[model samples]
Target chain A: MEAVLRCEGLVKRFDDRAAVDGVGFEIAAGETYGLLGPNGAGKTTTISMVCGLLKRDEGTVIVAGEPIDTSSVEERRAIGYVPQEIALYPDLTARENLRFFARLYGLSDRMDERVDEVLDVVGLTDRADDKAEEYSGGMQRRLNIGIGMLHEPDLLILDEPTVGVDPQSRNAILDSVAALGSLGMAVLYTTHYMEEAERLCDRIGIIDEGRIVAEGDRRELIGLIGEADTVTLQITGADGCAERVAAIEGVESAQLEGEELIIIAHNAGSLLSEILVVVRDAGATVKGVNVDEPDLEAVFLHLTGKALRD
Target chain B: MTTALLLARKDLVQRLRDRSFLILGIIAPFFVAYILSLVAGPVYDYGFSADYAISDETGSVGEGLAEGLVDSGFGAEVVGSEDAARALVDDGEASAAILIPAPSPVGDPPPIVVYGDLDDGTAVVVAESIAESIANQSDAVRVLITETGNPASVGAYLGQEPPVGWVQGDAGDKVLDGITYLSVGMAIFFLYFTVQASIINIVEERMNGTLQRLLMAPVGRGSILFGKTLSSSLTGLLSMVVLVVATTLVLGAAWGPVWGVALLSLAAVVNAMGLGALIGTYARNAEQASQFAGIVATVLAFIGGVFVPISTEPGLFDTLTRISPHRWLLDGFGANSGTGTVVDVLIPTLVVAGIGVLLGLLAFGRRSKLTGVV
Candidate 1:
């Protein structure tokens, strides 16, 4: 399948410092690619270059087989960008706002149809006549997303769409985003939220500092942890228990957190009894135990040496 | 072009919805114009006024001179003696004392000696005026006595049957009312604020991230900037038109020739918009831009003599005042009366618009560093 978006050696510099340093990625048709990282990790900057919002210092961004040109209005129409900020005229009605963006995109022939379609997709058709400022935060965010899709662009770029939203609104936005991928629109999603990336992305790229550190399917990326499972034990009087657990076979490392002792091993389920035995032998009482399977958060932590939330 | 128009329309609509912009741009101008017109005091006589004394002579020449001066809105009184007339001036009862000497014996007409307290500027002005009036009347007396051989009958002097030819020519009427000047000046001043509001909207959009979204849209950056400038210009134009019409309807302000005022207003709007764009380019945010625009507008208005009429007798201050667009606009409007044509308005209009375009281009260049200027 032809890729909907591709970037190679994207580099953007501010003065002497590189904001996006030689970063590159591609998104195929009908796929959701998530750039997962902590804040200031060049995710927004990289996407900005891809969407032609910022000038790249050294790079080529091809969207739907055309070089990304910030000066070319037609070339930019292939990709829709929903910025991090809720960018809308607060005094204008939802319909007016949509019409304005639609006009900007040169969608004159079927303007009303397109606006109504996007508003319905975002479930804002009922309140289309209300001023944007009168809408709740969630509604405004939905309208923001709706504007990006008005032109039916091949690739939609959403920059941190769910930041500062209520949980219900966040979930609604996530659901809408997840639904977009299934409808055959390539999505380039950028977020510092690990769960959002995990829940919606088909392929994820873990970026740090200013470059993508790793990119793959969830299982393949998580395998970077090498078959390791974390075992958490709620224990009391766990003196020397970490040393005891680390000495057990197949256990790689162990650490204690308050009353909980954590053990990383080759197979946490099989080593649970042994870990408990080791803890008890060290004169500590094991209240409970849990073995967690590898996930993207672990993959992020393993690769970057920092938690996804950090 | 369509994109630019759409963006411009969007800005105009949003500006219309902004309450603060409405108050500052429209309501405040009319309010201030009305209040300032009241503070400017009533429209007094455009001509001058003074008081003078004339001696009671045997002939009717002295009384005739005093009557002519009094009928022309001056204060004139006949005195029994020259000393009493001088006393009236010394005691501040009259501004000047004029003594008509006895008839000439050597065929040369008698001189009308005028006395005044030169220390008092009004007295000096009155004395000079009386001296001029009496000098003109003395010429008429000489002509009458020479032609008709009669010095007692001054009735012919007051009528067209005077010995000297009295051919009269029409004088130009007042250019405009004082209140109208105040209205136009205030309108132009507030129109600058309207332009500032429009340009500052761009900074507000940038701060709110809508500008970034616009950049990502399928429209050239030039289109965005052009649309913004056009919107600012339109805002200024609309505010001015509303002010003009409202003040005319409510305060009875006379706006000379419709086409002339329109053309001048267009030029003023263009000029204001350009300055606003330049200010917006330098300012980092909306608040800063607004503050800077306000200060600049006030300074321009003051120097342009928006609150007070500057003397127009070719001086350094009048030359300096010409640098401001407000002066040119008011000049254009004031010229609308008395056979004024489109060219009178067009000259200032084009000059202001040209200056605006230059500043707008510079502002576009500065703002274009991030993107391309429109």
Candidate 2:
């Protein structure tokens, strides 16, 4: 798969401080790349440079096989940027806003149809004729996303599209983004929501302090900390079952705390039957079992030593 | 350019929807003009008064000239000597002094010298105008005497009262009435706010996050700026045209020839846009820019003779008025008031437009700041 966006050594500085230092990333067609980081982690700055809205101090941004900068209008045509803030004319109707942006992208031909299609994609078709200011926050966000995709850009860059929106709208936006990716459009999404990245991004780059500290798929990133899933078994008569369960193939350790048996393993869900059988043979009457799996939050914490929300 | 036009079109639509153009551009100016007409009466009622001292050495011709001056609405007093006339002018008792030398023995006419106080520019202009009228009448008498070879008939011609041409001297003969002048002045004054408000929409966009989206579009930053400028110019122009038409039909205010008014209005709009853009470059947000533009527009209107005509007496106020685009715009309209062509207003139009271009260039030098993005 050919890369739709290839950024190399992208550096942006404000006065003496470097906001985005030597950042580089690539996203192939039909892939959703997420830049996950906390606030002030230079995610917006990096995306600004990528969108050609800001002049980079030092680096190169190539979109659709052409070098792009603040002056590269042709190359920018291949990009669709959805800023974190609702970037629509409040006085203009939703359909009017879409048409204005569509014209900016030189999509004048069949603009009405394209605008209608985007409005449907973002689920704002019914309120298309209403002023954007009159719409609810979710409807406005949907319209904002609709504008970015109206031109059918090859690479869509969404800068925290779900920020400040309601949960329902956030899900709707995420669904639209997921649908866009399925349409084979390359997407570069930036967000601090770990679940959103884990759910939608095919490849996630965990960014911290202006650098991608780790980058890979969900499992590969989780593997970096060498964390394993833990299974807890609550039993009424589980005495001395830890020693037997620890001898299991996939179980790393098993310890009995009063009536509860705690077992750590590489694949706790797969070893469930065997571990249960072992415990039963050891005269343990199982009452309940719980399995805890590691997620990106753990990975971010294990890597950055701070919670994702923090 | 096409993208710029599209952007300008969208902006125009937005402004029209808001009705800002109608209120600020047309209705406000017309009401101001109506109020002014009610308060100030007609333009002809406004009068210029000056006192003069005359040294009539050429007995009959000098005394006749002094009488003509009195008839023309000036306070003329015949003094003892030329030195006394000079002393009266020097002491500020007289605005000017007219000294008629003794008739020459040769065929050439004697030179009549008018001494005026330089500090009183209006008085000096009036005194010079009266003196020129007298000289022209004397020349006509000489021609009539030569044509009919009748000194008595020529004497009667000189004895009659000369036309009060000096009343229309400094400001020009075809002046706009109180209502019309105020209408044009208030219209152009409000145009600053209208055009500036439109130009600073970019700052509003930045605040609303639309500027970032515009920057991300396939258009260059220059196109965005140009589009904003085009929209502002069009808005300003539209406002001016509406006011001009409204005042003409509603208040019966004469704004001169259609082409001349059109040219001057276009130039005025461009100039206002340029000034707005320049001010916008230094502003961080829409509110700040509006406050600054309001201050500038008010100052320019006050100095440019918008609220009231500045003293024609040349001084610091006079020099300051010359620097204002408002003054030039009014001058353009005044110059082409009646029986004047577009060519009559070419200088003022060029001047107003040129200042705009210069300010626009200065703003362009700092265009990065105008975008509110670094």
Best by lDDT: 2
- State the lDDT of candidate 2 residue by residue for B1-374, as single tens digits: 99899999999888877887777776787787777766654332123467888887767766776677778766889987877887787777987777665666666565555566444544654555455456555652221011011223323333233223222222332345545777788889998888888988877888778988888787777888889888998888888888888888887777878888888988888888889889989888889998999999999998887886655444566667889988878777876763334555898899999999999999888877887566
Give native contacts recovered, as a fraction, per prediction.
0.77, 0.82
Query: What level of docking quality does candidate 1 show?
Result: acceptable
TM-score of model 2 vs. true structure: 0.80
What is the iRMSD of the candidate numbered 1?
3.0
Return the top candidate by TM-score: 2
Provide the global lDDT of candidate 2 against the true structure. Answer: 0.80
What's the CA error at residue A221 for candidate 1, in Å?
2.8
Candidate maximizing DockQ: 2
TM-score on alpha carbons, each prediction? 0.74, 0.80
Question: How do the residues A1-310 of candidate 2 rate in per-residue lDDT, one tens digit apiece?
Answer: 8899999998988898999999999999999999999998889999989888889999999999999888787778899888888988888999999989888888888898899899889888888899999998988988888888888888999999999999998898889999989888899999999999999999999988888899999878988999999898999777778999999997889988888888999868889999999999988899999999899999999999999889
Pairs that collide in candidate 2 are: none
What TM-score would candidate 1 get against the native?
0.74
